[model samples]
Target: MAKGKDVRVRVILECTSCVRNNVNKKSTGISRYITQKNRHNTSSRLELKKFCPYCHRHTIHREIKK
Candidate 1:
């Protein structure tokens, strides 16, 4: 198996507003962003403020289970 330390991991950040407001009810998915983080540097779940195309605004995006 590969070493887990100091490895870059892939994660998805989803828009908070869109989820809370229930925007895009017709769609079967929520707005999400793909990004990577250093496992050693930041072990905690990553949260970022990013623009959501569906919501058309900047919102706090929290990492979701892959």
Candidate 2:
């Protein structure tokens, strides 16, 4: 018989404004909100580099990687 406990998770949200220059603040805000909601099942944290077509810049976003 094997027994184990459930593992908790966490998520980190970042901005993706390093490409163009439109107005990704709203998008970033939304992303953060979403991440917050799913910050209870993340196994590993992975930083993702996303280039916003509207911002035309290289930004960062974190997520679970396992």
- Candidate number with greatest lDDT: 1
Tens-place lDDT per residue, model 1, 1-66, is 665653898899988777877754743457899999988888898999998777677889999998
Q: Deviation in angstroms for 50 in model 1? A: 0.7
Q: Per-residue lDDT for 3-64 in model 2, tens only?
A: 23434334555443421222543342323212433334544565667654434555675553
**Candidates' lDDT values, in order?**
0.82, 0.43
Off by over 4 Å in 2: 1-43, 64-66
For each of the candidates, give the backbone clash count: 0, 11
Please report, as a residue range, the 10-residue window in candidate 2 with the lowest summed lDDT: 28-37
Candidate 1 stretches with Cα past 4 Å from truth are 1-6, 23-29
Best by TM-score: 1
**Alpha-carbon RMSD of each model:** 2.7, 8.3
Error of 1 at 12 (Å): 0.6
